[model samples]
Target: MHKEGDEIHIDEQEASGGSKEGVVRWVLAGGLILAVLLMSIVWIIPAMTQGDIEEEATVSGEISSMEGGDSTDSIVGIDGEPGDGGEVTQEDGIEVIEN
Candidate 1:
């Protein structure tokens, strides 16, 4: 019952609606992608790059000062001295060693 021109007009309106929907979907998808990218840069980038701060040596300073030295030997139980046995004795309210 419809003429050719009327059929063509209906098809045109449907195509226009489809095009609008496609554009809206594309915009939403693009916004989502942009938000994800920004969140990654803001929240994730710093966490990924974070590391423990280390001591930086000056060019003229001696490297030996940075290295842990013979001070560890001063610890009593660590040296495995006789009668140490992971025990500290209390004498005069202070720890004294029989070794």
Candidate 2:
């Protein structure tokens, strides 16, 4: 019952609605891609490209004397005698002083 012009007009309206829907879908897809790119740049790229901290070196050494002597016989203190007020004792009895 509709005229030819009326049917053509209705088809045009439907086509315009379809085009609008397509534009909305494309815009949403573009927005999702942009969000993913920004997240990668902000959070992932920096962590991947970061550098490590530098370490320091440590040193150690020991002391030695050239004089060949009985280093173990070195006196440290005096032992206390029964009457003469405690006798002077040396560390390990290695008497450095002949008292």
Model 1 lDDT per residue over 16-89, tens place: 66554478889999999999999989977776665434222433233544464755436567544667776557
lDDT of each: 0.61, 0.54
RMSD of each: 10.9, 18.0
To one decimal, what is the Cα RMSD in angstroms of model 2 from the true structure?
A: 18.0
Q: Pick the candidate with the highest lDDT.
A: 1
Candidate 2 lDDT, 1-99, residue by residue in tens: 235854633556565665544788899999999999999889877666554321111121112221445556544434444553446547786743333
Clashes found in each candidate (C-alpha, N, C closer than 3 A)? 0, 14
lDDT of 2: 0.54
